[model samples]
Target: MPSRSCPRLALLALAATLALASPPAARACSVCGCGDPQLDASDPAAASGRFRLQLASEYLSMDAGTEGAPGSTDHLKQVSLRADAVWSPAEWLSLLARVPYVRKDLTTTGPGAQGPGSSLSGLGDAELGARITLLSRVDLGRGRSHGLALTGGASLPTGSNDARRGGERLDEHGQLGTGSFGPYAGLHYAFSQGDWYAFASVTGRFHTVNGFGYQYGEALLWTAEAQYRLGQRVAVSLGLDGREAWADLDHGLAVESTGGLVLAASPAAYLSVGGGMWLGVRAQLPFYARLRGEQSVGPVLVGGVQYQAL
Candidate 1:
């Protein structure tokens, strides 16, 4: 154990460095919601006529790290906290609502460490949806079963609009809201047997023109996940998700470098406590980004606590 200390220390040092690194400047984007594990809407663990409340936090850093301030840098950062509530009216139907608060920071250095930095923080769009289990678990004989579900939702424009700084409007990434309503639909499938589980989902968001005459591109999202139960109190999961967004439109015309595809990998873990309480954490890395122009999105880290009726 004595020899392991050095490697651990090195890793910590690297993480610290990454934390301080500034990310490239980008527009504020609240479209990317919390990296919730996309679990089955109709959780088998919860009985019908129950409520589940989940609270979560996330943070991400972007751009290049600087040893210290005093040099020019272009980076962005995001932090958010969210609450998700689910109500199951019956075994096959669930209603969901998600509310989030977000804070965004961007730094664009001019000369030395003395550069321009922009900050925006406020409530994000709220989402309301319903999920129905079209097919519940079907025993395949041999400790195996599968389920299917459908989900539909809408996002309300309830946050502050972009703030003008000296005759310039900060991009969407800098604004608190899109100033438009968004609607979405999705399908979910799950399979489980013994200690292993698998899930897949496909979702799409249809964006509408906001008050600013700008609209984020429509987004198509999909996720595939697999999990393994380690003992009774612990479960670990891995998933990959991809998003393809059509180019954003400004004044009804496509904006340069406004749309493309982004793919990420998520590794997560859950710890169950007594009384139907649990803790979950997940990390996402954007391994692939294909955009029209110069664009960048930071990594995302998520942690949450939840309580469900047994």
Candidate 2:
């Protein structure tokens, strides 16, 4: 009784079963926001055993020019607290440990502050590490990735090296720490594509102060960063860092230089409502800075929180 071509083949089989039951569309970006260009030698989860935890805070200030008093000025204030631990055991190997606490304040204006005001606090130097990743950019394909990591470290003097001012003491470049024994090395490179990212790093520190008379020393640090990703979770970063500290004063004197500049920001995606999470927020400002030549500018703030266990 129903034949008009069987009601047009039952309305084309009910429109092919309503297009196979619908549902399937959503992906503009969200895999934590997605920008993953590549270069993951690890650090941000690479499998094997896995474990990560970090907490950080850093603030540093400086103004210098006092070898023989070019205009007389030496002021520095530093506060830092950092704790980190990572373990991967394979997938490129990962094992790093960090612990730091520093507080120092030194001031010398005009006649080299030959009269008052000087301060220095406790626990300011401690480091021990290991990181190895010879090649990785997520194995080469998938976006654009690359990785090379090598670090060997040692730094421990505790803090306070007499710490005084108008009453003597204070040597070792005006003590607050650095009683000697410091060795460091670092290098990292990264590039991403999905959300965009770029990074570069170099670090070096070699010191052996022992007698506090100054003789052998070295310090060089450089960093560059760029990031953009406003989606899966949120990401934004801009950075430039520089430093040069060399010393060899015994009789020959000469070599001495200090430098600085760091502007940074990374806000969002580090949020964990309760038991853990709040992984990002780093703001730093230091328009330009110099040490053996004296100059000053300020702004430094840091916040942190990161945890993973599953």
Candidate 1: tens digits of C-alpha lDDT, residues 197-241: 677888877778888898877777777767766656666777776
- Please, what are the lDDT tens digits per residue for candidate 2 over residues 1-310? 1222211121111110100010000010000011111112223333468665666665655555655666776666666666666656676666655555656666677865576546665665555565677666553345455666665556566665666556677634445555666666677665554455555666675666465455443555555656554443334556554444454444446433333232222222223333324346544444444344344445555565655443
lDDT of 2 at 97: 57
Residue 225 C-alpha lDDT in model 2: 54
Cα lDDT of candidate 1 equals 0.62
lDDT of each: 0.62, 0.46
Question: Model 1 off-target regions past 4 Å?
Answer: 1-29, 32-42, 62-74, 109-115, 166-169
Error of 2 at 205 (Å): 8.6
Task: Give me the displacement of residue 60 in model 1, in angstroms.
Answer: 2.4
Question: Whose TM-score is greatest here?
Answer: 1
